[model samples]
Target: MAWYHSYFKGLPQVAWKLHQDEEYTDFEVDFLRDVLELKKGNQVLDILSGYGRHALPLAEAGCKMTCIDISAEYCDELSNAKTKRKLPVEVLCGDVLETDFGQGKFDAAYCLGNSLSFFPRADMLRFFTKIAGSVKPGGHVALHTENLAESILPNFQARNWMPVGDDIYYLAENEYRPEEGCIEAQQTFISGSEKVTHTVYQYIYTLAEISAMLESVGLKVVGTFGNLEADPFVLGDEQLYLVAVRK
Candidate 1:
């Protein structure tokens, strides 16, 4: 089974809500405009591009983008965005690890929204190698993911619930595995007359771990920050947006 499809399909409503909220932050847009240093006619790849959050804006910016994602729904969302403006965007539905996109095809690349946190440590290293292989020489890559080192991991199982519009959001429990350096989040959303549950597992990588993984993949960490604004990485920053150059 395709992991991304299964994970995202179960998360449509929340993901849609995250993008739809009026005061929502369009970090993708900020990255394209500010962090990515995108030049005119840059060929870019949005690895795990979800729901056109990053794809549409880059296309509108006159970028020739190859949007890669495993979710058909998200891929269609990109198509719909292009149709809305009669723009051209190549949206491909496939796995990032298996897709034969050809090495050094893109001028630059980006992976945002904590998309890189889905894999285990070794797979994450492999992911970096794959991304580096896809990037052309002198090109760069911007990766966005949670700063797991700053994440507040509770010591015991705790139940928490909140409301998101019409849905009652609930985290049934969460546990931190210190030895494994991972956090397990089990959650459920109750909306109207239905309830759906899903578990989100992620590794809590320290700054050192991330740096090492990049180096192991032959990518040099050019810069590391807490956000798209290039804010200095502080002791408690929750976002890690790393910029790297292919070696």
Candidate 2:
């Protein structure tokens, strides 16, 4: 898994070709700007903030941003971006699972793009413990995860890839094994004249499981939406977006 290990090491250019799509970025930005209700003067922490794609813009909007990541490469890249834009952002290289931060440090916290899928239950518990300790009392945390009830992966052969920019492409091809609760996929990217690929294995979680995780960390699931727009969720049509309040 050295390739997976290198995920934070500057994104291998192929990742940009694979994932830096307008649809993908637009979807995320809409959520951050609209669903998360990002505003000026708010202090926020982004767990697993990838390459400052989300944090940098928030900084530009007059918020102080703290980004923690598992990749040193990404930390450095974020630092470089901070210097370029002079954004008020602090980038830390550490395991999101157990990063130590003082209580009430942030006005809000967020984890997006199904990053938790990379961890199993115990590890997710550790991350939540730290996050619960990181946010201020009554602060909020937004978590974005796939709504498996709406996923359309009916068969393994229903795989496809779409290009992003001139180089990157994203592949969402896989099948969910109900009993196993995992979606298996081959994600491929051709970046900067190099080919990068990964066999991505992810566990699917129900809305109930997501709520349970939040409750376990002393957070309450106040809202659950079907998409980034906070629409009434049609369980069989799309992913789940959640907003939880800290107690």
Candidate 3:
């Protein structure tokens, strides 16, 4: 299996452990709703939905959600959450690159948390194309990730450690390979004397490159932001948040 496949296969537990802040979750969900213009009963497709952080909130907000993840474990967890909460969510376990989203089946779709740039350029383009095929004409697409600007910055910190709670912390190490148009990271999670590590191979996409790919897939750029707060994307911004409309 590829590094990402192996890494994410069992990542639901660790990822959930680190991202349990309800306040931030609410804020992000609100941001997504605004970015996608989510309406009650609107059909939404969430690619790489993981344990359904965003999908659950969207579902609760009245959108019909189809959440997909590469990890069966995560998808099962999402399925349980849907049942427990009685939310309108469909959970599927499959590779996003290979999954079929029926033509014009959704009103909007999104791939957030740096999920868009995981594959090589060609594959990434195909992914966008597939996403376009799933959404109706003029539907929305939102993408959130750290942009190439920060990755190529001179003062970029390649390694960092952060505590999620009293007994849990994560160490992340990044290696930028511009020639290969990717950044590699090894993430180590330490929780109560137990340590788990995962490797991520992310292909870096510049704003222009990503824009072109979306356009090629018939998704036109509509808005750009630096964060969930909706600040305009500019140099030195912490990350990239783009909103596009299917054309």
lDDT top scorer:
3
Model 1 lDDT per residue over 1-247, tens place: 4234476665444644454443234655766556567877889888888776666767787888888888877788778888888766888887787787768998888887677667778778878888989988878888877636764442233566666655555446777778877767776776667677777676778778888888887778888887666787765777777888878
Pairs of residues at least 3 apart in sequence or in different chains that clash in candidate 3: none
- In candidate 1, stretches whose alpha carbon ends up further than 4 angstroms from where it belongs are 1-5, 10-16, 19-27, 153-157
TM-score of each: 0.88, 0.81, 0.91
User: How much is 206 displaced in model 1, in angstroms?
Assistant: 0.9
lDDT of 3 by residue, 116-164 (tens): 6678888888889999999999899998886465544645669988776
Q: Arrange candidates by lDDT, highest first: which order?
A: 3, 1, 2
Q: What's model 2's lDDT at 149?
A: 40
Ranking by TM-score: 3, 1, 2
| lDDT agreement of model 2 with the native | 0.71
Model 1 steric clash total: 0
The 10-residue segment of model 1 with minimum total lDDT is 15-24
Could you tell me the C-alpha RMSD of candidate 3 in Å? Answer: 2.0
Cα lDDT, all candidates: 0.73, 0.71, 0.82
